[model samples]
Target: MVSFLFLDFDGVLHPQYDGEPTPKEVCFCHLPRFEAVMRRYPGVQIVISSTWRQQFGMLQLRAFFSTDIARRIVGITPTYPADGPPRMHIREWEILQWLKQHHASNKQWVALDDSQGDFRDYRHRVVFCQPWEGLSEHRAVQLSKALQGTRL
Candidate 1:
């Protein structure tokens, strides 16, 4: 089965100190560790679940990552309403919508986010990260374990 990783930026990337950042302020603090771990799981593809994707669009958003990581991104989660006010409780809904569109129920998927949000039944697929630490070494290890089809 295909393996998918739903990646969040703010808290999960670095730290969500002052809320949403401008394009220039987006610092990839722990991206090196993230890349080190991801290198071991070449089959896993990333789907941006960050609000950045909703704000910046794919072309600009992909520019945030290094070339190696950028190549692994398959897509971003769909925006709410197709147009209009952004929907609340989007992480869970967007993921399900994307999965349905891709016919990807059988794929192994995981989300790396600081807030639990409304994961609901998909809680088992999450690898909770600390906002202050971003993707720490321990967290990356947990993700690697999950990607290897093992319990973290």
Candidate 2:
């Protein structure tokens, strides 16, 4: 049983950034991909592991996701801490802390993020994504396979 699926909203779910000249929102492309993955794996628990906490509160975040793929999520973790060196760097720490608090070991969790850098010592468990390569069909299939292999 896969205990938790940590998802980064921006690049993985939505596009990497906003305010582009094309005016095409990243989120528009995300919904379909996210829905497809959700349909194939309904038993997995989804958690919001995005770094958008600086701009949106938990309520706003919940509402945003609820409008799109709400049924896929079990719950959102506490908003990422604000007072940190930088917003991007804090998510890894916050994720680790949350896992420890809930007694969810790394083996039972998989973090999908666009940040390609090593996750310090937890590099083995994280699934890194590229900014341009938002969740693809092949990646989703791989994730499903990984989840199945996870030790409950």
Specify the highest-lDDT model's number.
1
For candidate 1, report its TM-score.
0.85
User: Tens digit of lDDT per residue, candidate 1, span 1-152?
Assistant: 33899888877778777565624555787777777888888889999988788678777877877888789998988766767566555687888888888999677788888777647677778888877667888898888888887862
Candidate 1 lDDT trough over 10 residues, lowest sum:
17-26
Off by over 4 Å in 2: 18-24, 65-89, 103-107, 150-152
User: How large is the C-alpha RMSD of every model relative to the true structure?
Assistant: 2.9, 3.9
Write down the lDDT of every candidate, Cα atoms only. Answer: 0.79, 0.63
- The per-residue C-alpha lDDT of model 2 at residue 89 equals 46
Which ten-residue region of model 2 has the weakest summed lDDT?
19-28
Tens-place lDDT digits, model 2, residues 1-152: 66677788666765565534222554636656666665566676777777565566666766755444565565555555456455444556767777777766553677777775525665555666666666776666666666775522
lDDT of 1: 0.79
Clashing pairs in 2: none
